[model samples]
Target: MARCETCGNDYDRTFEVHMEGKTHTFDSFECAIYELAPRCAHCSVPIVGHGVQKDDVLFCCNHCATAVGVHELRDRA
Candidate 1:
Protein backbone atom coordinates (compact mmCIF):
# COMPACT_ATOMS: atom_id res chain seq x y z
CA MET A 1 0.00 0.00 0.00
CA ALA A 2 1.05 3.54 -0.71
CA ARG A 3 0.40 6.41 1.68
CA CYS A 4 -0.25 9.94 0.60
CA GLU A 5 2.58 12.17 1.73
CA THR A 6 0.29 15.09 2.33
CA CYS A 7 -2.86 13.62 3.87
CA GLY A 8 -1.43 10.38 5.23
CA ASN A 9 -4.14 8.32 3.56
CA ASP A 10 -3.48 4.79 2.48
CA TYR A 11 -4.30 3.79 -1.07
CA ASP A 12 -4.01 0.74 -3.27
CA ARG A 13 -2.95 2.37 -6.52
CA THR A 14 -0.32 4.96 -7.30
CA PHE A 15 -0.95 7.33 -10.16
CA GLU A 16 1.86 8.70 -12.25
CA VAL A 17 1.25 12.27 -13.35
CA HIS A 18 3.37 14.50 -15.52
CA MET A 19 4.14 18.01 -14.38
CA GLU A 20 6.83 20.30 -15.81
CA GLY A 21 8.18 17.39 -17.79
CA LYS A 22 8.62 15.33 -14.66
CA THR A 23 6.53 12.46 -13.40
CA HIS A 24 5.19 12.22 -9.87
CA THR A 25 3.12 9.64 -8.07
CA PHE A 26 -0.02 10.32 -6.04
CA ASP A 27 -2.02 8.04 -3.82
CA SER A 28 -5.46 8.93 -5.18
CA PHE A 29 -7.40 10.96 -7.70
CA GLU A 30 -8.26 13.67 -5.20
CA CYS A 31 -4.63 13.93 -4.12
CA ALA A 32 -3.53 14.33 -7.73
CA ILE A 33 -6.03 17.09 -8.34
CA TYR A 34 -5.04 18.86 -5.18
CA GLU A 35 -1.47 18.89 -6.42
CA LEU A 36 -2.38 20.11 -9.88
CA ALA A 37 -4.87 22.82 -8.93
CA PRO A 38 -3.77 26.39 -9.53
CA ARG A 39 -4.43 28.06 -6.22
CA CYS A 40 -1.51 28.89 -4.03
CA ALA A 41 -0.75 31.34 -1.23
CA HIS A 42 1.73 33.30 -3.31
CA CYS A 43 0.00 33.07 -6.70
CA SER A 44 -2.85 31.60 -8.70
CA VAL A 45 -0.59 29.35 -10.75
CA PRO A 46 -0.43 25.62 -10.23
CA ILE A 47 1.83 24.26 -7.55
CA VAL A 48 4.73 21.94 -8.18
CA GLY A 49 7.00 19.75 -6.06
CA HIS A 50 6.03 18.06 -2.78
CA GLY A 51 2.80 18.88 -0.96
CA VAL A 52 2.85 20.61 2.40
CA GLN A 53 1.47 19.64 5.79
CA LYS A 54 1.87 21.40 9.10
CA ASP A 55 0.47 20.09 12.35
CA ASP A 56 -3.23 19.59 11.57
CA VAL A 57 -3.14 21.92 8.56
CA LEU A 58 -2.96 20.79 4.95
CA PHE A 59 -2.15 22.78 1.85
CA CYS A 60 -1.82 22.03 -1.82
CA CYS A 61 1.62 23.43 -1.31
CA ASN A 62 3.55 24.95 1.51
CA HIS A 63 2.82 28.48 0.39
CA CYS A 64 -0.95 28.17 0.03
CA ALA A 65 -1.35 25.85 2.96
CA THR A 66 0.57 28.33 5.01
CA ALA A 67 -1.36 31.22 3.51
CA VAL A 68 -4.84 29.78 3.98
CA GLY A 69 -3.97 28.38 7.38
CA VAL A 70 -5.68 25.03 7.77
CA HIS A 71 -7.53 24.00 10.88
CA GLU A 72 -9.02 20.79 12.17
CA LEU A 73 -12.25 21.09 10.24
CA ARG A 74 -13.18 17.45 10.66
CA ASP A 75 -12.96 14.79 13.31
CA ARG A 76 -12.70 11.17 12.22
CA ALA A 77 -13.26 9.97 15.71
Candidate 2:
Protein backbone atom coordinates (compact mmCIF):
# COMPACT_ATOMS: atom_id res chain seq x y z
CA MET A 1 0.00 0.00 0.00
CA ALA A 2 1.13 3.52 -0.85
CA ARG A 3 0.09 6.92 0.41
CA CYS A 4 -1.03 9.60 -2.00
CA GLU A 5 1.16 12.61 -1.42
CA THR A 6 -1.30 15.19 -2.71
CA CYS A 7 -4.53 14.13 -1.01
CA GLY A 8 -2.88 12.30 1.91
CA ASN A 9 -4.94 9.20 1.28
CA ASP A 10 -3.77 5.72 2.10
CA TYR A 11 -4.39 3.87 -1.08
CA ASP A 12 -3.79 0.25 -1.98
CA ARG A 13 -4.03 0.84 -5.71
CA THR A 14 -2.28 4.15 -6.19
CA PHE A 15 -0.39 5.16 -9.28
CA GLU A 16 3.09 6.67 -9.45
CA VAL A 17 4.39 9.46 -11.58
CA HIS A 18 8.10 10.14 -12.06
CA MET A 19 9.02 13.66 -13.06
CA GLU A 20 12.30 15.55 -12.86
CA GLY A 21 13.80 12.67 -10.89
CA LYS A 22 11.05 12.92 -8.27
CA THR A 23 8.45 10.26 -7.67
CA HIS A 24 4.87 11.00 -6.58
CA THR A 25 2.02 8.71 -5.74
CA PHE A 26 -1.64 9.53 -6.36
CA ASP A 27 -4.76 7.65 -5.44
CA SER A 28 -6.64 8.94 -8.44
CA PHE A 29 -5.91 10.44 -11.86
CA GLU A 30 -7.53 13.72 -10.82
CA CYS A 31 -5.06 14.29 -8.02
CA ALA A 32 -2.13 13.15 -10.11
CA ILE A 33 -2.70 15.47 -13.03
CA TYR A 34 -4.01 18.33 -10.92
CA GLU A 35 -1.04 18.44 -8.60
CA LEU A 36 1.64 17.72 -11.19
CA ALA A 37 0.35 19.28 -14.35
CA PRO A 38 1.63 22.52 -15.84
CA ARG A 39 -0.73 25.48 -16.03
CA CYS A 40 -1.06 28.09 -18.73
CA ALA A 41 0.36 31.50 -18.00
CA HIS A 42 -2.55 33.43 -19.46
CA CYS A 43 -5.62 31.47 -18.44
CA SER A 44 -4.32 29.29 -15.61
CA VAL A 45 -5.68 26.12 -17.16
CA PRO A 46 -3.95 22.79 -16.85
CA ILE A 47 -1.87 22.07 -19.92
CA VAL A 48 -2.48 18.42 -20.66
CA GLY A 49 -0.94 18.22 -24.12
CA HIS A 50 2.07 19.96 -25.61
CA GLY A 51 1.23 23.61 -24.95
CA VAL A 52 2.24 26.67 -26.87
CA GLN A 53 5.50 28.18 -25.73
CA LYS A 54 6.89 31.65 -26.17
CA ASP A 55 10.25 32.45 -24.72
CA ASP A 56 9.93 31.06 -21.17
CA VAL A 57 6.15 31.38 -20.92
CA LEU A 58 3.61 28.65 -21.60
CA PHE A 59 0.09 29.06 -22.98
CA CYS A 60 -2.70 26.54 -23.32
CA CYS A 61 -3.37 27.55 -26.91
CA ASN A 62 -2.41 30.08 -29.56
CA HIS A 63 -5.34 32.30 -28.62
CA CYS A 64 -4.10 32.57 -25.06
CA ALA A 65 -0.62 33.40 -26.23
CA THR A 66 -1.90 36.05 -28.57
CA ALA A 67 -4.21 37.46 -25.90
CA VAL A 68 -1.26 37.91 -23.60
CA GLY A 69 0.76 39.67 -26.30
CA VAL A 70 3.45 36.98 -26.23
CA HIS A 71 2.76 35.20 -29.50
CA GLU A 72 4.52 37.64 -31.79
CA LEU A 73 5.98 34.82 -33.78
CA ARG A 74 2.55 33.37 -34.38
CA ASP A 75 0.98 36.71 -35.26
CA ARG A 76 3.41 37.16 -38.12
CA ALA A 77 2.18 33.95 -39.71
RMSD of each: 12.2, 2.6
Q: Give the TM-score of candidate 2.
A: 0.81
TM-score of 1: 0.39
Model 1: per-residue lDDT, tens digit, 29-57? 77776776654444555445444555543
Which residue pairs overlap in candidate 1's backbone?
A: 41-64
Candidate 1 residue-wise lDDT at 18: 84
Tens-digit per-residue lDDT, 1-77, candidate 2: 99998889998999889999999899998998789889999899988888888878888888899887864645234
Q: Pick out the ten consecutive residues of candidate 1 with the lowest summed lDDT.
A: 68-77
My TM-score estimates for the predictions, one after another, are: 0.39, 0.81
